[model samples]
Target: MQVKIEKLDHFGRGITYVNQKICFVAKALPNEIVKIKVTKETKKYIEAEIEEWVTISSYRIPEVCPYAKICGGCDLEHLEYKKENEWKREKVKELLAKFSQIEKVEVKEIKYLSPYHYRNKVTLHGAKNRVGYYQPKSKNLVPIDTCLLLNQKINELLPKMKRLARENKVQEIMIRTSNDEKESLIKISGDKPKSLIDMKDITGIFFQEEQLQGKEEIISTIGKYQYYLSIESFFQVNQELTEMLYEEVLNEVKKVKPKKVLDLYCGTGTIGIYISSEAEEVIGIDSCSSSIKNANHNKKLNQVKNIQFINNKVENVIDQFQQDTDLIIVDPPRKGLDKKTLRHIIRIAPKYLIYISCDPVTLARDLKELKETYQTKIVTPFNMFPRTYHVECVSVLVHN
Candidate 1:
C-alpha cells in the first residue's frame, strides 16, 4: 500500500488516511510517499511499517543508534530537533482537541533541554547473549551498544555493566546518575551480587533479588532537597528538567494560594516537598510502599513539619484525605488517573488542580473528564525528554 504522510502522530509515526480510514506508518515523514506493509489492522486505524520511501522529509536526519528502527527507547531520534518540538506541540493540540473538544489550545513550544546525553536513568533487559531495550512491543531484546538519550556517565558504565552481566547471573540492570555526575548507582535484579563490583565513578551499588529479598537503596539530592532512591521508587530521569518541572508545579501552587494541598501519585514526595513551604500543609500519597517511605524520609531530611507521606493508593484512600485540602496536584503514571479516582476527586472538588503528565493522550482524556467540574486554565509543555516523542505538560484546572 502507498500512503502519503500528512503529519507525525504522538509516537512520531506518520498519519495518513488509507482506504477511507487512518493509517499510522512508522519511519515515514510528512509530505512524503511511502510503500508500506500493514503491521497491524484495527477498527479505528491501521499500523504499517515502511517498506520503501518514495519521498522523504527534509527534516529527517541520520539516526545515531543502529537499532533505532527496532529499539523502543528513542522514537523521534531520526527527526531534526527543531521540527521534533513543533511536532510535539502539534500532537498535544491534536490530542486535546480530540479528547476535550477544545481546538486552538495554546501549547508552549517545549523548552529545548539538551538534545542528547540528558537522561540520568536507564533500564536494560538482559538475556544470555544480549542486553538492551525490548523490541518495540515484544519481549525480544534488541542489542544496543549505546543510546544517545543517556548521559555520559551511564554510557561509560554500560560496557562494564554489560561485561558483568555476561560474567554473572544477571537478569536486569538499572543505572542511575545524579545531576552533579558525582553520584552513580547500579541495581542488579536477578541474582544479588555478594559484593559491589569495583567500578570507576560509582557512588553506590544496589541489589534486588528475584525472590523479593535483599533490597538496597541510594541517596540522591536535588539542589537543597534530599531524596532516597530505591529499586522500586519512581524518580524523574532528567534532573535539570525535573527542577524546572517542579518549579512549574510550585508556580501553580503559588498562583492558587491554597491553604492545604494534596499531592497524589507523589513519588518520593519531590513535588510535595518542593512546595511544602508555600502551602500551610501538604499531604503526599503513593501506592508504592518504598516510595512513600522515601518520601517520609525526605520529609524528615528536609525537616519540613507540615508535610506528610501516606503509603496508600490515591484511589483507595481518597476518603482519608483531609477535608481541608483546597488544592490537588497529580503526577500520575503513564496510564493516568482511573475512573474511580476521578469520581472521588469530583466529589471532593478542590479549588485548584495541577496535573503533571508525561503522556499527553492520557492527560487530555483525564482533562476531558475533569472538565465536568473544572475549567481548563492553562497548559504548558516541557521538553523533558528532548530527542524522544514523549512530552511533559503542567496543566492547571480551576474548579467551576
Candidate 2:
C-alpha cells in the first residue's frame, strides 16, 4: 500500500492513516511517500515495513553503521542530526501539551554535542558465539563487531570481548568507559576471564560480587569534579551532555540560591556536589547502596563539605528533610516518580523543584500533578542520547 507519512511517533516510527486507523512504518519519514507491506494489524493500529520508496525525505541520510538496519541500537541513524534534535524538542512540547495541560509551554532549544561516539557505556548480549543487541523488541540477537555510539576505547576492545564472551559462555557483557576515554571497566555475567586482566585500557573487571581485576571503580572527570563510578552505579551514559545537563542544573540552583537542597535519586551525588558551593546544605538520597558508597567517596574526593549522602529511598526519608529543604531536585528513572514520592514532594512543597527526566511521557504526567502547587513555564530538552529516540529534559517548577 502506498502511504504518505504524516508524522513521526514518540518512538521515531513514522505514522500514517490506513483505513482511518493509525499505521506505523519504521524507517519512514514525514512527507515521504513509500509503498509499505503491513507486517501486523490490530484494531487500533498497523505496523508496516517499507517495500519501495516513491518519494524520499530530504532529512534522510545514509546510515553510518553497517548494521543500522539490523541492530536496534540506533533507530534515527538515517535521519539528519539537525532534524533529529528538532524532532526531540517537538516531542517534548507535544507531550507537555497533551498530558500536562500546558498548551503554551516554552521549550528551549535542545542542547547537544557530537552525534556519534557519545555513549560512555554499552551492554551487549551474547549467545552462541555472537554478541550484540537484540533485534528491536525481539529476542533475536543481531551480531555486530562495533557500534558507532560506543566510546572509542570500548569499540577497540570489542573483538577481544567478543572472543571472551564466546570462550567463557558469557550471556551478557557491560562495558563502561570513563569520560576521558582513557579508562574502561568491564562487567560480565559469567566467570571472570583471566585474559581481561591483560587489556591495558581496562582498569577494572567485575564478575558477580567479586572484583576480578584492577580497581573496584573507575573515575570519570566532568569539569572540576571527578566521579568514582562502580559497576552498579547509575550514571548518565552520555559523558559530554552529562556535563551540560549538570551545568544547566547548577545554573538553576545558583538562581534559586537555596538554603537547603534535596537531591532525590541522586546517583553518585553528581548534581548535588556540582552545585554544593551555591547551597548552604545539600542532601543526596538513593536506594542503591553501591551508588551511595560511591556518592560518599565522590563527596570526599571533591572535598565538598555541604552535601551528605543517604542510602535510602526518597519516599522513606523525604519527610525528614521537608522542613529544612527549600529546593528539590529529582532525577527519576524512565518510569518517572512514584505516587508516594510525588505525594511527599507535594507535601514538602519546596520553593523550587527541578525535575530531570529521561522519558517525556512520564515527565508530562508528573508535571500535571505538580502543576497543582507549582508553576512551570518552560522546559529545556537535552539530546542526551543522539541518533536514538530518547531525550532528556530539565524542568523547573516554582511554588505559587
Instruction: Report lDDT per candidate.
Output: 0.82, 0.90
Cα lDDT of candidate 1 equals 0.82
Name the candidate that leads on lDDT: 2
- Which regions of candidate 2 deviate over 4 angstroms? 191-197
For model 2, how does the per-residue alpha-carbon lDDT over 1-400 read when each residue is reduced to its tens digit? 8999999999999999999999999999999999999999998999999999999999999998999878867879999999999999999999999999865678999999999889899988888867888987887998888888888888998997877877787778889989999888888886556465465778888887778888888899988999999988998999898999999999999999999999999999999999999999999999999999999999999999999989998878876754567999999899999998888888888889999999999999999988878888569999999999999999989898
Q: Give the TM-scores of the predictions, in the order they appear.
A: 0.91, 0.98
Residue pairs in clash, model 1: none
Candidate 2 global CA lDDT score: 0.90
lDDT of 2 at 334: 96
lDDT of 1 by residue, 326-351 (tens): 99999999999999989888888899
